[model samples]
Target: MKKLTILFLAMVIFSCNNQPDKGASDNNSEIASQGKIPKTEKEVGSNTTINDYSQVETEKAVEPDTIKTNDNQDINYQPADNNNTNQFEDNFIGFASFYMQFDKPKQTFILKADEDKTITCKEGTKLTVNENSFITSSGDSVTGDIEIRVKEYYKISDILLANLSTTSNRDILETGGMIYIEAFSNGEECELKKGATIEIAFPAKDKKDDMQLFSGNWESDKVNWILKETIPVDSEENAGFTFVEKMPEFPGGQQKLMDYLSKNIKYPTRAKESGIQGTVYITFIVNEDGNTEDIRVVRGVDSSLNQAAISAIEQMPKWTPGKQGGEYVKVNMNLPIRFSLGGEDFSTNNIDYAKEFEKQVNDSNLSNTEMLEISHYIFSTSKLGWINCDRFFRDNSPKVDFLVNIGTSKQVDIKIVFNTINSILTGSTSGGKYIFDNVPTGHSVTLVALKYEKDQYYLAIKKTKITREEEQVLDFEPVTMARLKAEMEKLNRI
Candidate 1:
């Protein structure tokens, strides 16, 4: 009993020593869990969680900063022959920054849907990033593939870069468009180009490496490049992949205003010295015509920055303008006007192509044919005059019309009349032979000759006006050819 008690006491002592200091250990554990203690495991966690939410929190530990870049001045880089540089800041967006100046790494994503869940990304419609990643799907597809090309910093002259900064203006991070939601459908193939949605989580960075790369180019207002899929994606309801939908300035989006302010609104030197690193949030009404009619501070920056920001806001062109339903309505814009100077400088091209267009117009004239006509005066002539109509030929006077047949199947029917002293034979075949002499001396006459078909004259001669009618051509040649005229004369002449 004594030995057993001594052993038990030793065991109890060992247990007590091994036992954690209840209060201290508990507090330490709590502190450790609270992230006061930054550990490698906490910084880069192993997401072996049964639930997605827990995994997401762990993944957020290594999340990159959500810094927003400025895009307002991007107009300076607009390609020639383009007009209205992103005139309306539409949902279609474009963005640039030092990060963009950095090399854009090719990032890929693949979703392995639950199984046999049919999800199709239609041609123009895109299934973009979702808020979470619990793909409830069977047949999954590549909803959207983005190849974010980050610009390398080499161009901005390293001299100024060291002074460049990641700003306290957190708004710069707002427009990273880093999150996306794709569509998972047991429904019909989702139409592309149409706005559609399905939820996907921004996966842990390691899982992102597992994303499949597809081939081909996909130009979205939000993203670009081929998915470059290495592995086939599965489609289930919540099993699909979710990427960052935070696409850079998709044109026609309101965030552009923020992006502009984030970039252009530098911290007033005075404001900075005063320790005001925060931004001024401005919300203005952009009318349907795309002008900022009213400017109000959603959050006041200051008198100097506020007025400056307001002036800048008022100078802004018409926005796409947000809407609650289908009607144009006023919306609030939280534009953070930071006094950041190290960001990119975007300039608008002042090269006026319109001036060039004006020059081109000044050098030339354009007119549509309004009226076209050829006046005709039928002349009745004697037998001898009609026979010598060929002698009165003219070339290209408005009075002479010859170019009836241009080529091949293109043919024009012609009509004409021979004017002589006798009005009796003025008209075609029925008029028979007529006589003529000299054309009026001062003027020229063209013989309006007709090419007869099947011995029947369809219309008046379509050649030219005959002017040599002062005398007569006693030498007569049959208008219908000599042989045919001879046969007619022999058979009918009295």
Candidate 2:
């Protein structure tokens, strides 16, 4: 009986020693399921759990992904999932959202729907809407106050920041200007009533005779302009005399015209800083009423200098009317305004006198009598969205595709600015490459890349001449919002 009792005690002790601790087993199972390493009692502190200890170790083992640019700007980097295509598209959308803040604000006007109204914008665009002209999207008549929102884009800066391009059906266009108009009633979108039209008169200082009306079709994010109607021009104004008995003369003759240009043409600050100097050829018609009309830039160098030359020409006084067959007639005249910064004083009053004298001496070879084509773009439309005044861009150069490799999986917003034209092309991504197709070869262009991630703004800019099917690798650097704005402002001067 004593021996059996000892055996029983030994068996009990063996069972106790072989059995697992339920608490430790449960904790270890939980940690294994979470893909974390289980820690021993000695490794884990008194207050910390095994999962917590594993997490601390894992974090310490893996470093954060980051990139440092040449400017010493740090970018928090995240490797994009190659399996997810939507993530790339989402990144692009985010970039668009951030950069769209630079667009011009809409000018809103509240008007009674039952009353006729003539609204004039601060930029001199006139809108005339007849009474009861608004309808709901479902074709129901809208009464009460209608909200009219108008946004005008006259400057190249506005166009670039707005992500707008001058293109029609994949064909290039040279824009006179662009306007966006929308109407809302009761916080819902409204449309123009059928058979009721809104008249628009867009003021143009550099009006083109070939300018036509185009309606913008928004496909996704970009606008594709469709040729709509031909702007009508008066036959009388179009019948300017190329050869006349008495040529139209400036108010004080050629010398006075040269002096006026020298005194009034303010050299654009941006142009002076960039060392942009050239002659802008301005063409205008001196009408029978002794007034300058249909002013335009036949050839331009820089946008700022071109605008300055156009502005000076627009402010000229009435000239002596040309006479053809002993009757007052309209005549076309071309003026070449030279912009030079050879002297230390780069002020308007301190223009290069020698250059002006040389230009005057060469002016004798220019024809004073030429026929002018008139442009009167007054139009009535029942559609409201983006209305553009544009002409087809004529280029004889060979076209090629331009590709950009950012060497990153992150999506970016890309823009290609044509240095010589008022055109900006948005880039699209394919096979991890940003592509711009059919770009004119042998032209200077500025490539811009923008990104927004983790509340950080990044930018990259490159100016290059397109010679062939070229691929450029761009590296982006973090930039402050102010720096980004300043950089964008510089693109405006391109």
Best by TM-score: 2
- lDDT tens digits by residue: candidate 1, 224-307: 212211211123332211121111121344345434443454445575456433234555444444456556765554677677
Candidate 2 local lDDT, 304-327, one digit each (tens): 988998888788888899775578
Reference-based lDDT, each prediction: 0.24, 0.61
Compared with the true structure, model 2 gives a TM-score of 0.52
Residues forming the 10-long window of minimal summed lDDT in candidate 1: 6-15
Q: Give the C-alpha lDDT of model 2.
A: 0.61
How far does residue 422 in candidate 2 sit from its true spot (Å)? Answer: 1.3
TM-score to true structure, per model: 0.18, 0.52
Quote the lDDT for 399 in model 1: 31
Query: Where does candidate 2 stray beyond 4 Å?
Result: 1-93, 138-144, 186-188, 231-377, 452-455
- Which numbered prediction scores highest in lDDT against the true structure? 2
